[model samples]
Target chain A: MKGTGCISLASCKEGQTGKVIAVLGDKHVRERLEVLGIRKGTVLMKKVQQMGQGPIIAAVGNLEIAVGFDLARNVIIRVEV
Target chain B: MRVLLTGNPNVGKSAIFSKLTGIDVTTSNYPGTTVEFFSGTMNWKGKTIEIVDVPGIYQLNPEAAAEKVAAQMIATGDVLLNVVDATNLERNLNLTLQLMKIGKPIVMALNMWDETKHKGIQIDVDKLSAILGIKVIPTSGRSGEGISCLADAVLNAKQAPETNWMDKDRWKTIGFIVDKVQNLSGRKHTTIEYIQDLFVNPVLGPVLSCGVLYAAFTGIMRLGKLIEKTVLSAFEKYYSHVILTISKFLGGSGFLHEILIGETGAGGVDFEAAMGVLTTGVYVSFGIVLPYVFLFYLVFGFLEDLGFLPRVAVIFDRLLKKAGLHGFSIIPMFLACGCNVPGILAVRNLETRRERFITAVLTGITIPCMAQTALVMRMVGENDGIFVLLVICTLLTVWCILGLFLKSTVKGITPSLLMEVPPYRLPGINAQLKKIRMRMTCFFKDAMPYVLGGIAFINVLRITGIIKLMGKLAEPLITGVFGLPQDAVLALIIGIIRKDTAVAMLAPLNLNSTQTFVAVIILILYFPCTATFTVLLRELGAVDTIKAVLLMLVTTISAGGLLNLALSTVYTPRGLLITEILIIILVIEILEPVKRAATEKKQ
Candidate 1:
């Protein structure tokens, strides 16, 4: 499973499930994401990504969190095969 | 003893607080609705207990303003009333564990418990209580179930010793606890779930939003007109007769009569032109403005409770990005359409000062309140209606242009949108009415003074000849640059006090359609009214407030000057509109490169 390709959460296709490999950003961005359950090792399913550069939605344990484009770009995830 | 109600955002903490305390605080379906703490007292077992509804936060350690407010509030509480959304038990437990670490006596309310049944979520309340060494009661804020039992538990709740688990990984502990007490039975996708999916679908989302907005607009218009035509007209008929009798007794011509009854004619009081404290004052605030404001809050509260707003925010995030804002900024802009004070207050929810600044400035400079929009429609739109459209479109363009300009120059981080898109639920009619009633009370208390004061101020200006003198003084700018008659200056001056009054003031000027359009645009762009200005100062500090006001001045002058030239030069209104559109395109085209270069330099 770890051998599957890793990609930025922003780059993931809709409906794809992945584990967040790393949350790369400043302390503020990382903390904001973490509180919403987007921390390292948490699995999230890509619900939708609006208009390429728009915010991305991820489903983590029945909760849908919308991550902004810039912040979403910093969320690196490992695609689960 | 003080009990602080705290929870994750959108977890119905506020709803439960309202239930616990019987205080009608604003409760909505979105996060960040309550940015400040509200305290109320409840009597339990003959003891008065103070309950503080702290702003929602996902963690005890805070970053955003609202979260910081919550964190600050937690220290003062004697008991922690942690409200947990039962369906999302695992995530909500993250915050509960953090709260439990404070060593304060804590009671848990498994809120939204009613929904857990339908969603196939089962929680063994007794087991969870035993595991955490706390009382956990199942309650539904919507149904008011188990509230008294929760209150009883809260009163008798004992402090737990500082947990040894605090040294361990918190999420790991939460996972362990949830695993023991929680079970989920798989259920088929429901219609609400399907509608929720449709709301966020990229293509369908925008289309649905348009449909929702159009429906809301027409509903507000139809309802507002119904109230005005039926209730207001009946009110005016009986009201005018009594005031007319008083006018006749006072001889209807003196200064006293002018102050009270205004200029009464054979047809009685023309409330619009009465210029009296009693006549136009009451008419404008209660008759013309109240119905629309009532409807706006009604519709807004419905949409808010339906949990549709966050999805709308998601849809508009991309466009708002150009302005250095995200989709969350839409809430403030939408609220501003009702009034700017609440709009400005909502700015505290924005994470960064930069987003707040842009949202505040754009709202003050461009967005017209519902009252002003209604009056403008009646005052100007009654003639052509196209001019109202022109004014609205021009303000929108300014919002876009000014946003782009401010986004590029302002120094700060534009935090990305990370928010929960709460599931849609039927808006509780009782909660909606309570929210609207509270907001209407605020309108009466806050706005009525300004409306009446503005009318009295205008009458003083009329009596003292100051208005005429000022009109003469501003002739160069008013007549030369804006192409409005000299008398139109008074409207611009009173516009600072109350925008609706300013538009109503234009009614007496009887300007042509072109002049009406130009003047209305300037009125909107010049500055925010007194109430909004005070809030703007408080929300955005003095320095940024001054910057916003200065931007308003520049935007007003340039927009007014350019619009005047275009309207005067173009042969027809259509041509003028085309010129406006062309100018917007040209500005965006020119700024695109500048923005690109700025980004490149930053990289």
Candidate 2:
């Protein structure tokens, strides 16, 4: 498990496909993320967005979620290809 | 039964559809393409069920994009899941009642049930069901809460006799049923209560607002540079070297090479031409815009979700009303910062034609879009800090001044500030992202084709002798008036197609810092974007479109040309600094009187 500093989702490069190590959120948010399948060990590919690493387009299965720098900072991901 | 899922924008309609069909239709590309009802098959109780995700909308009367699609969906649904934003019960119910008036086998899915709980909102589900004469399934699509119960409710509604939400004029009915069954205990904004006074405490609000904006710009720039270096460097190593060779091998000052590569002959390296779109267009789209756009969306969404936008709405309300519009018009203007199409289209919800016209034109002209903002922020912000601040300050000043101009300078009755300030909430993560994606996707999709095509077409225009002719024809004003080199005509021509490409065109020119500033100003005030052009044509028709163009043309030439001339003589380091300070003081002083007059008028 590793924590990366805040980077836009679009800029998450290859070989750094991260395991979503944690999701820090409030109540509705906790539910929202869980519903969207953004859970612990959820394998996520950083889908390069219109903005690289500024807003990482994180994908789990068919769900694509854009995370800005702030939210991404809190999301510890196990960086792996 | 063919089931239709529908609701107001950002409601759980798509969320529910995704849950039911397990299908994700990228809801991003709305501005570029019209997505009718999306269909996917679901297996329910060992039987194949066809599910349709209708576009979200407020009314069957069909105002917005989703509304039209929903109206179309309702026209042909066997069963309808009328998803309601349960927290905003009254607002959601208004639309639900409208759908019920249509006499469909409707199932009211109360989405966002989790939020309703926190708000101390109580909707007796059974009572609401009985009152509406429809099965009401209170659902939280977020946590997978009550989803099965919702599915069961849909199944039950299919077997049972159908019912309506209301039989007569629904507000009258809703006013009654809601009066009895719905209890909205106004929760002390536990929520944002502590921050409310802090965020908008007159003096405190301004300080906080300025501090936040300053931080946002600084944060985006600092982070944006790192992302750009990382993303663009990787792209260059992969693509630039390859495309450069291929572009060289083609070896022609001819149409094909020019169109394929740029006229500057810096055709990125091999495969890079094919791939440099990622390097340049895609990189610009994501990298440059990403940091700031994300920041913009995050900050704006937080402000929005925290209910600050409404307070801003309250502040801007009287100003908006003066221009024959309401404070709601500010949304489109805000959205205009992303891009102008939706910003323009969003004007449709305005109460009157005059409001839409003024808002559309003003948004088109005044709002520096993502592409332009990206370019300005990237080039100017990175290279010079104080100048960048100056530009941003100028932008804000212009927005306020133009807003006041639209409100007062134009002779029209002040519009109303009739709006619903949604309660402040810690904006949901997924919801905020969903909103951001919805916006940025619309921007990217609309711009991508035009950007690629504009680059290609600019290349084609150069070799085809079209640019030479344009340069010559526009020489008098382009050079003589605008005080720019004839090459600037090319930038202006390209600006019509896409603004960033026009600025990108400036890279080849050996212009000094002052010239570039003038160029950017010209780009901002010069003309409406292609998307904005179409919307203007649609909303104002031909005559106003022409007037709009003329207004832009006169302003661009005058503003840009005058600034250029003035700066050339007066822009010695000491003089320019002094002038800026004086202008700042003058502006603040001008604003004080205006505020006083406005307050006096109010009294």
- Leading candidate by lDDT: 1
Interface RMSD of each: 1.0, 15.5
| Model 2 lDDT at residue B225 | 67
Relative to the unseen true structure, what is the C-alpha lDDT of residue B94 in candidate 2, on a scale of 0 to 100?
66
| Top model number, TM-score | 1
lDDT to native, each model = 0.87, 0.62
Report the Cα RMSD per candidate. 2.1, 15.3
Clashing pairs in 1: none
lDDT of 2 by residue, A1-81 (tens): 334443322245633577766666555443334333455556677643222112233555323343433445555566663
Instruction: Report, in order, each candidate's fnat.
Output: 0.75, 0.00
**Candidate 2: residue B65 lDDT (0-100):** 42
Q: Mark the regions of model 2 whose C-alpha exceeds 4 Å error after superposition.
A: A1-81, B1-14, B17-80, B88-102, B155-191, B248-255, B262-308, B318-325, B378-386, B393-414, B427-444, B535-544, B569-603
Number of clashes recorded per candidate? 0, 26
